[model samples]
Target: MTSLPQQTDKKLGLVIDLDICVGCHACVVSCKEWNTGGYGAALSDQDPYGDHVSGSWLNRVHSYEAGEGANARVVHFPKSCLHCDDAPCVTVCPTGASYKRSEDGIVLVNEDRCIGCGLCAWACPYGAREMDVAEGVMKKCTLCVDRIYNDNIPEEDRVPACVRSCPANARHFGDLADPGSEVSLMVLARGGFDLMPEQGTKPVNKYLPPRERPAEPSSCGKRSASERESTADATGFFRWLDQALERMG
Candidate 1:
């Protein structure tokens, strides 16, 4: 069995804002693109473009409809490794392949030491770990460890690929343990929460809850003639015309 670090100097992790994630899957694509070639084994897609296509991915976005009527909205949740402080996956590894870094608190797998055992996957509560069938090894998010500490890359571009490629700027990365860090402040201000605190994993990543929507008509009722017209204005010409007409009238 593997043992965890006593403590880490910096708790490097991500702070995700649920309010602005548009379910674009940009993070997912960017994560796969970078990790496939940069670190670990290549993420393989079995029978791609076929009916039963399946592939290994480090990040995934899930859509959920919340509330009802006027408050109903789709919540796009982006999930990956949390790099827990007390990582169950690490402790469950028989060969010591799974370990948490005492330097940065990043949980990682040593592919060479791994015996293609699925114990890590079963131990993780977040469903963050995935097994690469082709390689016969378990794979997971490394938090872009290769990119963050690399002196080769520019300092400004050291964040994880998902954080850099998020179209809505919904993802943030930093040392979460530092109270003055941007990620920590964001988490504090937004009342960020853990996914499954009850499990006692103590995940490093935090998620900002969705903002409250203004009280208004339900989606069914809100689609008035003007709203329909606005939707029909593919290029916003009619929208501008309507605005101008309203200003004049």
Candidate 2:
């Protein structure tokens, strides 16, 4: 039986897989291509070749190292607007342009009403919002609303540009409100975590946890049992303790 459209509101959103993301920055490029040229506003880059290079991106990939010193690990986090249920960004906007939709959990900026005060950017702890210098207005991900709703685009290609362009397939778009939805299932199965959950953004977007690699065993491989030491001149204290413990056991 065909499911009624109203039965599940298409509250499309993104799920980021930290485990599989290679930090290739493909999604960043695709976003730049679509958004820098598309309807909202141009994502401005201050200087293409200058020493100080800064720009607006609806999406940004951040690389981090976990643990300390030699045992440290790398983590690639792709940051974007969470489109939160309790969005501080929306409420802080003095002009009332930024708002959360009841139809879908998407937080959107009404470009017509935005006054470009940039208070929303300051309000956002995730640094998801940006000001388009060229347009002199704030800009953020629209979740490809224009493309998703357009009749001309193929249904398969109607997803947000970031999800469509992800080389690692780390980004997924769907309704999180529906328990049966693919995004919902994936989040449940993976135990995905919210960034800075204490902030209480109630972000619609979820990030899959980083997969843990097996720890390498310590390199103290020498032992008296394995190798005969004629005089024990070179043996360390741990080796002597190991020999004593082995005999005691």
Candidate 3:
């Protein structure tokens, strides 16, 4: 089994704002495109136009409803490899294929060393690892490691593909190790939190909770009675896809 580094030099991660995320799925599509083409093995689709279709995807957003009445909301939860400091996936790798980088704290799989055993996926608490059925290896988010430090791309476009493609500007990437970093400050301001604190993974990525809905209508504008009564059900990322695919069938 593999072991984790005592510490990493920098904690590079993401901050997702749940309040503004429209559940558009721009991030998910962007991630699939970039990872398949730019970084690792291709993300293959099994029976894409047929039935029981499944394939590899590094990132996924699961939207679910929480709370009640005026306080209720459809939260868009984007999830991926958190690159936990005490990454269970890394420690459970018998072949030592899954490892965390000491420099940036990014958890990654060395495909050459991987045996296609699926142990890392089982060990992961976030369900972030994906099996490449075509290539017989595990794949995951690398935080666009190749793009972040590349001199070829424009400075403004160097962020992870998901962060770059989000139309609402809901995704942010930065060094979380620095207290003064923009991501850290955003966490402090928004009361960002871990996915499952009880797991003790210490995931680097933080999520800003969705703000509570106002009880009274906004004074600046008025809404039709029809709009007021309407509710958004499963309009979030993964659920939307599930509903769309079901309609096709």
Candidate 4:
């Protein structure tokens, strides 16, 4: 078993907003595209065109139905390695392949040191780790370590690929240890939560709960039929005028 760092300088992690995630899978696709060739081993797709198709992906979106009847809503959950403070995946690695960095608390695997024993995957309760069938090694998200710290890329773009590519801007990345950081402040304001608190992993990543649905108006705010029609007419005229202006410009 490998020993984890007693303390890390920075608890770098992600904060996902459940309120605005549209389940577009943009983050998922972007993560796979960047990480497959960015760092570690290439993500392998087995029998891609066949019926038994499978591939190693670091990020995945899961859809769930919550509430009932009028309150029913489909929630899209994006999941990945939580980079737990007490990471079981790191401790269970017999060959010391899986390790969490003391500098940023990012969990990573050394492919050369990994024996493909699958112990790390089993140890991870969140099912974040996956085995690349072709490469015969366990693979997981590295938080885009290569891109985040790379001086070759622009300073403004120094974030995980998923965070950069998220169309809904639901994903956030920053130092969680800093309470003044944007990510930390958002977590505090939105009542962010962990995946499995009972497991005692103390995951660094936080998830913002879905915002409460606004109460529906009983009678459309008591708008008269003629007033509604007039509003619609004005809206249409403005929309048409805006399009004409764009074309002329």
Candidate 5:
């Protein structure tokens, strides 16, 4: 069997900013659109407008509620293939179709070799793998490999479509192997945490910490931008005045 690329101990992956994510589902929708229409066949939709409507999606967004009482908060977690370092899906594959890359640390599928047994899907805990009904093969996000390498596409737009369409700019794509990369920097600065680290998959992707709100009461009711600015300016003026009086005394 051909070995998957494991270059220089560097793994490429995504670092998602949970603080900026609004749970808009834009990433989910765009991912569906691109994967459905790209080199991969349309992502299998089991039932449309039916009672049990669920389909194969490489990515899915989950909204979670946590904490108790005053400290409680809602977090929107977008789940997808972690492309784990120890991918069970690859080991379980009867064919060598599912494999990881040594050069870039990307997990990819060989659609031509897949038998459509769905065994790989069962092995994945993150539910990152998907089966293409049309092609009778399993499919998952290639991280837009075709587009990312296409010379025709612009350099700036080489990243995945989901990363491009995100209005909140919460998604980032780069080589995790490079410690100084932007994704790595943001991960360190914002304290990005992995999901299910105990599983020992060592997922390439990371999620930023949830926003921390202060204990102070939030401003209620409608207030114009100008009014809010005026209030802020007055507050600053009063603070400066107090400081000056203290110095004089």
Candidate 6:
């Protein structure tokens, strides 16, 4: 089995805002493109236009409607490998194929060393690991490790493809280990929470909850036309996501 690093020099990860995600799947597409292009393409599509269409992708989003009637709101939740501090997938690997990097705490799979074993997928609680049926190797988000460190790319484009391509700016990338980092401050201010924290994985990525909504209006009184318009404008997801993120401070 593989062993995890006792400590990493930097904990690089994502901070996602649930309030502004538009469920556009831009991150998903960008992740697929970058991972499959020049950066050691590992993804595969099983019958692109057939009945059972499936593809190996690192990022995905799920949407859910919370509450009902006037209190209801659609929340777009994005999911990916959280690169946990105590990554069970790494420890569960029979070979040393899966390991968490000591430099950045990024959990990654060395495809050459991998034996196409599904142990890592079973060990991951987040359902982040995907088995590439075509190649029989495990695939998951690597935090765009290649793009992040490449000097050839423009400095502003150093972030993960998903982060760079997000239209809503709902995704953020930085060193979460630094107390003063923008990502860390955002977490502190927004009360970012880990996904399935009880599992003890200590996921590096954090999610900000949807902002609190106004109190439900009384059924007895109908909303005035201007009041209704204001409410509708406020709740429009894509319309004001940029403004909201800016005001998020």
Superposition TM-score, candidate 4 onto the true structure: 0.86
Summarize candidate 6's per-residue lDDT along 55-106 as a digit string, tens digits: 8999999999998667789999999999999999999899899999999999
Candidate number that wins on TM-score, 3 or 5: 3
| Pairs in clash, predicted candidate 4 | none
Q: List candidate 5 stretches off by more than 4 Å.
A: 2-10, 216-249
Whole-model lDDT per candidate: 0.92, 0.81, 0.88, 0.92, 0.79, 0.90
Write the residue-wise lDDT of candidate 4 on 111-202 in tens digits: 99999999889889999999999999999999999989999999978999999999999999999999999999999999999999999999
TM-score of each: 0.87, 0.81, 0.85, 0.86, 0.82, 0.86
Cα displacement (Å) at residue 63, model 6: 0.7
Error of 5 at 113 (Å): 0.7
lDDT of 2 by residue, 7-114 (tens): 224456889999899999988888888888875777889986899998889999999988875567688888988877677888877777887766776778888888
For TM-score, candidate 3 versus 4, the one ahead is 4
Instruction: Give the range where candidate 3 is weakest over 10 consecutive residues by summed lDDT.
Output: 213-222
Candidate 2 ranges beyond 4 A from true positions: 1-10, 69-71, 217-249
**Per-residue CA lDDT of candidate 5, range 1-249, in tens?**
334344426677788887778899998998988888886567878777899987877777888889875567788888877777777788788889889877666788888888899998898888888777767899887877776777898888888877888899989998776889998898888888888888777788899988788773434325556664453334577878866876999
Worst 10 residues of 2 by lDDT: 1-10
